[model samples]
Target chain A: MDEMDNQFVTSLKENYQIVFQEIGLLEQAFTHSSYVNEHRNMALSDNERLEFLGDAVLELLVSQYLYRKFPEIPEGKLTKLRASMVREDSLAEFARECGFDQYIRLGKGEENSGGRQRNSLLCDLFESFLGALYLDQELEAVNQFLKKVVFPKVDAGAFSHEMDHKTKLQEVLQRAGDVFIDYRLTNEEGPAHERVFWTEVYCDGQLIGRGQGKSKKAAEQDAAANALRQLNE
Target chain B: MDEMDNQFVTSLKENYQIVFQEIGLLEQAFTHSSYVNEHRNMALSDNERLEFLGDAVLELLVSQYLYRKFPEIPEGKLTKLRASMVREDSLAEFARECGFDQYIRLGKGEENSGGRQRNSLLCDLFESFLGALYLDQELEAVNQFLKKVVFPKVDAGAFSHEMDHKTKLQEVLQRAGDVFIDYRLTNEEGPAHERVFWTEVYCDGQLIGRGQGKSKKAAEQDAAANALRQLNE
Candidate 1:
């Protein structure tokens, strides 16, 4: 291994205590598509495919974790909980916490454009890293890696605040009495590929808040969150 | 075990040549929500939670399979192939082939309503069964089970026709000479939860076919499929 590769391996060992059977896979995971596009002679593959595989790995592991942790929680709640944990921002936060941002290789253009700090790129990097780990050591090693990095945040209830905005809004509204709560779809816009939904939440026939999202349920939750903020203010 | 439970276990062994470590989980896998509601005194849990976990398990396994099988294919195409394989209709077909439809428990009302042969219910049952298998024996056992039941169909190219309609259409259109193909979003309707998108595919600015779907890409694909069908006719 070159000095750079040796440093990378040593850093992983020092930080997470992870040893890779195939260090190439680990290097590929840190490789961005833009970097590969620029360096054609190196024959290096980007992290997109690894990101795809790692996304599924992360989904299954997170699902398994939530499945065991909340034995009595219904499937819908569990789904929401899993979503909160694995969303782009959360994953990006985890990647930054692990200092993965320092290792990603981006094209000069992307680097100049501040791609290193982008949430989507960081999230993809984290997932691709997990994918490489799974390919190198299988699910158990990936699970152990997550037990060190991701699960503690979940255990500390860091994501709990993002889970149920609608429920929280309802609780706040119902503090007065048994009031009628309704969410109505007001408008939808954008192209078929990126449709936006707008929703308004009403408390006893009074329009409390309006918000928008990519889906109706998300829009409703957004409206509820808005209403909660307004009510608190 | 009761006679019915014993018979269920025996049928699993005879049909799939498999045995579960925790037979109760297998039983739970087959229990529908309606059945639990009807058999309130039995304290039987429904398959919904298992279905959630199984859905994730199925995604990872299918993803892993596709990732290995087509190393040359891009992540986008692999994702589409995975979706085609694990869709509700496809899963229902698999469940029916495995005789899982006959084993799913339904309330008398649901039975009267013809829920036994419903695709959604059958699909849920199949996923729940896989979930149960995973819980009882872990991913490798579930992988073995899919190798027997699901992977063969994939190996046979049973689902290839459902993939890449747009690409197929493009091949046909480009056969004559250089041609410009365009997909235009015509309209969208329905509530936020069930929004429908309509798209028209045009050849050199001439409208060829129109179709609608849940998303823009799906609508575009549907339009392409319709164009292909019209051309074939």
Candidate 2:
């Protein structure tokens, strides 16, 4: 390795204590598909494989943590909380805090197009990093690493990040072709200026969630949020 | 604890080495929701919470193992293989092998209705056991336990259990929401007694898979199977 590469490895080790016995694994974690596609002689693979493995590892660790943390919470609630915790945006935040964007190797086009700061890229980069760490350090080490990085955020409630539930719900239901989602205004009451509307969301004629607000749009959003909560997707 | 309960706990400790500091936790692992529902005076919760935790633990451990064992396998193949390994039927088989059916505490109605041997119940039971084990002993011990139970199955090729492609594909896509799956007969040619039929499967108008067989039904099944393999779901 050159002096600059040695410094990069040493810095990561000194800062995050992320030691990779096989340095190639670390390189692979940051290598984007665009980079691999651009370089014919590149000895490294893209981060997708590592991201896949890391995705499972990340999920398992978080789920285990939540299960132990909230002893009384039921499965449905735990699922919802877990979904919120591991969503792409939340993971991208973790990546940004960890400086993963600085390490990503993007092709000229992707770099020019601002791929380094992309949410999906950062999220996948974070997972790939975890995958590399897991291979070199194994589960206990990964657990300890997550305890240091993620657990504090979880404890301080930093990971209770905002989620666009209306869009999220729509995206999920849209992927399944035959299912229909309908938000109906079930009731409207109160004065004109102080009007209240109750909305109920249904999936294939089955009522999934209900919410009330001053406007139909607000009521629909609330209803969509409730549907997401109840469905636990 | 009663005499039967004492014997049960002691036997598990002696045979399986599952020593619980809080015996209530162990008891809670085997407690079914039906049992808690029936016994109003019982001061115990169901296994659902533990199952949820255990499910995460199980996925992480399995993912780590696969990543290490198959260094060259891509993410798509690894995901499909992992899904097969951790599906409900596979977990239920593991539970049966562990003899958890005898220890499950079902309500009189459920017990009489044969809930003890049900695949869903056994799968949840297995996860609950792992959850209780994790809480009592932590990750390393739980890892060792799975290493004994699940790893052997993976090695012996016992875990490549039967999976119906059409059903599994539909279930996954349905969960996603907007994709429609359709099987089309593309070609049929041969003698009357020995004829071959070709089929293609589409997902939302995009051709995803194609296959050939002796009969139309068989060809459609082959097409669906191909779709599952090609889509990696």
Candidate 3:
């Protein structure tokens, strides 16, 4: 039997409660580029391809879940919710919770470099695993896995901060209706290449907050952020 | 009987060969917000919810097809490929080919504004229809529908240009092996708020192309475009 026919399949079954009919897919999902590079004689592809597929699946599931859960929310707000849920940091946290890091098969160099502890590595691995799972058993099995692991965090308000401050501020203001909120450039300095910009955000005619940044867009974002903070207080 | 149960369902069955068991889903897919707003007493919802669902379904289907078809392409390239395929323009073209615009239920105001002819509206309609199809009939039917309508265009070389020029140029250079590509900021001008930046793209220590744009990133993209055009020539 191949490497995948043994401990790999058993461990997936035992730990994750995942049973793979196409065990090779499960194995490939755990196999990193580093591992494949180190093991040239063995025929094994890396998880990057699977990671690609998994990322889409994960996004769709999260998006669907959010859409159903937040019936009253608009598309833009729903987008932010999805983004926060699927962002690198949250996916990495999900990976850590699932112990997906421990299962990652890396080259000796990457393994020695503490690849397992790295959030990026773990996040990619989680995505890769999900991709493989989707292929092996399709969406039903994948949904079960996510329901057991990921969705509960939504109820705990863990993702509340993940929403963009500017968007949140706008949503709050827009719901109140017909309020003119404007961001104006107040100051500009430094060289053209490394320019600094200061912006003031006004609610009606009163300056609510001021902020500075390296670009006009950045400055506006900072100003909005400041306004959000002040308004919240 | 509802509007969908009458000629709408008959036409879908006749034209698209799509016999939706849950015909209500197919109806809602084409039902615009304007229709729901105009007919407030009618227990009809707009297609936005299905549009959201369909967008994800379309993405997943496209991703799966690409993954299986192109075994040699890297994930990044696959992502670019997917982006090109699902982009509003391409999807709008797909909608036009499918004649989705003809069946869309729009508000009278929107309809008078030539909404059906609008690419964005048609594209959303196509996605909403697909979303509704997935809900009613599932993946097999969706796959069959796409095979008959979508995948043929892919083979006719319709999708070849959707991938970014920079990545294409890089891929070409990389295929030749051990080549260095560098994008340099050649010049910066105009005001900080409306900056015009020039960039030069270098391949293997030689400048291949130069371009200017409003932002550094845009300038680099222009430079990359120039390089690709030069390389093609």
Candidate 4:
């Protein structure tokens, strides 16, 4: 590794408080799958697995912090808050703030296509970074990283009761008319263990929107969310 | 108020070590919107707020616990495990086991319709219960409740890598000899803040599924997930 790479590794250890025996894992965490596929001989590992791990750690830490901070919010609202906090856009923004774009390894094609700047990819790298941190330093270190990085970014204003989508949707739709929202099951397929549903939203008689999910209800909610956004816009 | 109620309350405090002051919050946690709407006179306090609080608390505790217990597992696997463990179904099951159903204050209509037995409602109540626990007791108390009621049910065997439909669909389609899954955008309308998109999945020149979401990408993913499920079936 070059001096800059060594310096970067040292800085990460100082920030996350864990020294990695295999800086390879750190490299892997920052490596996009695009990079791995491009260089077949390098035996490069992708960050997808690490990102997945980091996502959980980040969620837990954020969830706990929010719970402690706001004792009055409900589960639905909390879920939304967590969702908002950890969404791809937010995570990507965090990655950018942390200078993740500089460290991530990308294939020439990906680099040409601006893959390093993509929110989805950046978000994945952030998760991978967390995963790498957890792997090297342990959970406590990951927790510390989350506390320092992700928690502060969670908007306090957005999480309050008034800002909740379901609530907002309910209030806005109720004021419009006696319109009842129904989620009709348009289609269903797959095994009994893991079924998926396609649902459409009907507002009065108009077919407003459609959504799909692992279950009928999840699809319906997604449809409702879509409809709500449409109506608001 | 009655003998059964008094005994239940007493047992709750005795067994759980959560004081009655906190139990009051727990009782409130089981109150759903259905119950609140039914009893207009009471202007009832619902479990939504508590559920929100509890959700955050639950995530943190589970994350911390999983982090401590599984050292060898990478972050991605740990995240999936934690998500699987703390999802709605698990929370609802835990609520039922904690005797949360018996304490719920449902409207006569909801009660007659068997609201207490509903898993969805139970999940909310359980979240609210956690919220109340956080407020009435302490973080330690809430952690204790989670350890006793929620942790055991999360068998690692049930945890699947392909839990998310979007990821599953992507993998499935990629393996099915299709490089580009065509998403036909039917419509997109709304403001910058809340935009909705309607899209259809086209594979081999056939529209397989339709979906809608706040963003085009989400809608496309939904369609892809639906298409994947249908293919599997």
Which candidate has the highest TM-score of all? Answer: 1
Candidate 2 docks at the CAPRI level of medium
Candidate 4 residue spans exceeding 4 A from truth: A10-28, A34-46, A61-82, A107-109, A131-233, B1-21, B34-44, B56-90, B133-151, B154-233
For B44-139, candidate 2 gives per-residue lDDT tens digits of 699898888888878877887877665556787778878988889989998888778888889999999999989999999998888888888886
| CAPRI band for model 1 | medium
lDDT of 2 at B108: 96
Candidate 2 lDDT score at position A169: 65
Comparing only chain B with the true structure, the TM-scores of all models are: 0.69, 0.66, 0.67, 0.62
| Model 2: how far residue A212 lies from native, Å | 16
Please state how well chain A of candidate 3 matches the true chain A, as a TM-score: 0.66
TM-score each candidate. 0.71, 0.65, 0.66, 0.53
Q: Model 4 captures what fraction of native contacts?
A: 0.47
lDDT tens digits, residue span A1-233, model 4: 77767777877767756577778888888788888899889876788766666776676667667665544455566677778888899889889887888888888999999898899999888888887887777667777777677765553233334344334444455554566656689899999899999999776778877888898768876787787779868
Best by lDDT: 1
Reference-based lDDT, residue B216, model 2? 89
Q: Which residue pairs clash in candidate 2?
A: A174-B178, A175-B177, A175-B178, A175-B179, A176-B176, A176-B177, A176-B178, A177-B177, A177-B178
What is the lDDT for B23 in model 2?
80
Clashes of each: 0, 9, 0, 11
Q: What is the C-alpha lDDT of each candidate?
A: 0.89, 0.81, 0.80, 0.72
lDDT of 1 by residue, B69-168 (tens): 6665677888888999999999999999988887888999999999999999999999999999999999999998899899888766577675588866
lDDT of 1 by residue, A81-117 (tens): 8999999999999999988998899999999999999
Task: Compose the digit string of candidate 2's lDDT tens values, residues A68-142.
Answer: 665545788778878887888988998888777877888999999999989999999989989888887887677
lDDT (10s digit) by residue, model 3, range B14-116 = 8779888886787788888888899999878888877787888888888888788656678988998889888888888888886677777888999999988
Every candidate's fraction of true contacts kept comes to 0.82, 0.79, 0.50, 0.47
